[model samples]
Target: METTKWLLDPAHSELTFKIKHLMISNVSGAFKNFSAKAETEGMDFSKANINLTAEMNSISTNNEQRDAHLRNSDFFEVEKFPQLKFTSTQIEQTDDESFNLHGNLTMKGITKPVKLTMEFNGIMKDPYGQEKAGFLVSGKINRSDWGINMNVALETGGLMLGEDVRIQCEVQFVRQGINVPVEV
Candidate 1:
């Protein structure tokens, strides 16, 4: 069997997360520098092996000071662990278009199991004659599970940040081959 390689189209992909802040509101952020790649036997991405990486220092929450603190020792510790990575270990097709992606997520020098629910939005040929595929991914993980416990209590009798973080990504992939669809 021949495998096809797919590379992420950074301009068409986004990695974002939301966490509770001040015990009342949610703070959203994104990682500006990230990359992903996948290898599969064909257009059937249900069994694709996916690998992704994001630069910890590229985290942006729209606030310079908060972003800086997130990269500091209390949070991501970018100087010591600069990259967050995920590599798929197993992928199960829950339906024709939906899948459960089981993978190992590494952050701040710790690796943990993670499962992402993904929706495969099908493949298409752009006007430029490029073959592209789209996917919507979502998952949640506890920040403390990765040693990111920056516990700061507020005067209002609650914590400053939430423990669980919601992660979401919209990724578009460009096939390495021509516009022709691969046979599974």
Candidate 2:
């Protein structure tokens, strides 16, 4: 068996999240700058070591005002905590194509263990003859767990924002030694 490395294909990957707003609607946001990498033994993802990081300053919700608020001290505090990171601790295969990814997510200087579901989309050779792997990862976390406790009290007897944040990411990775030209 040989050790294989995979680098994130940033141009083909995205990290997005959804949160309830005003207890009625969902607000969507994404981190424009992020990266991930994986190391596996002979392409066995079950034994892979994965790491990921996202630039806090790249967080965007489409609306500048809301985005700015999220970056302030009331939320992520991008100035003090410039990046959020995750390092996989364990991976348990649940089915033929699905697995439970356990890792420690660090944000706002706080670290917490989290479990996420990962769907392995298999590996294929691209038009450029490069080996690429895809995955869909998703999970939910409480905003307050990372000390992001900012919220408004709606006069209607409900909180403005929900504590639960739904994370969804579609990521693609290119095997090391593959010369695939990527825009970003």
Candidate 2: tens digits of C-alpha lDDT, residues 1-184: 9999998989899999999999999999999999999999988999899999999999999999999999999999999999999999999999999999999999999999999999999998887777889999999999999999988898989999999999999999899965666443
Q: What Cα-based lDDT does every candidate model obtain?
A: 0.93, 0.95
Candidate 1 differs from the real structure by a C-alpha RMSD in angstroms, to one decimal, of 3.6
TM-score of 2: 0.97
State model 1's lDDT: 0.93
| lDDT, residue 2, model 2 | 93
For model 2 the local lDDT of residue 87 reads: 99
For model 2, the stretches where C-alpha displacement exceeds 4 angstroms are 179-184
Residue pairs in steric clash, candidate 2?
Answer: none
Estimated TM-score for each candidate = 0.95, 0.97
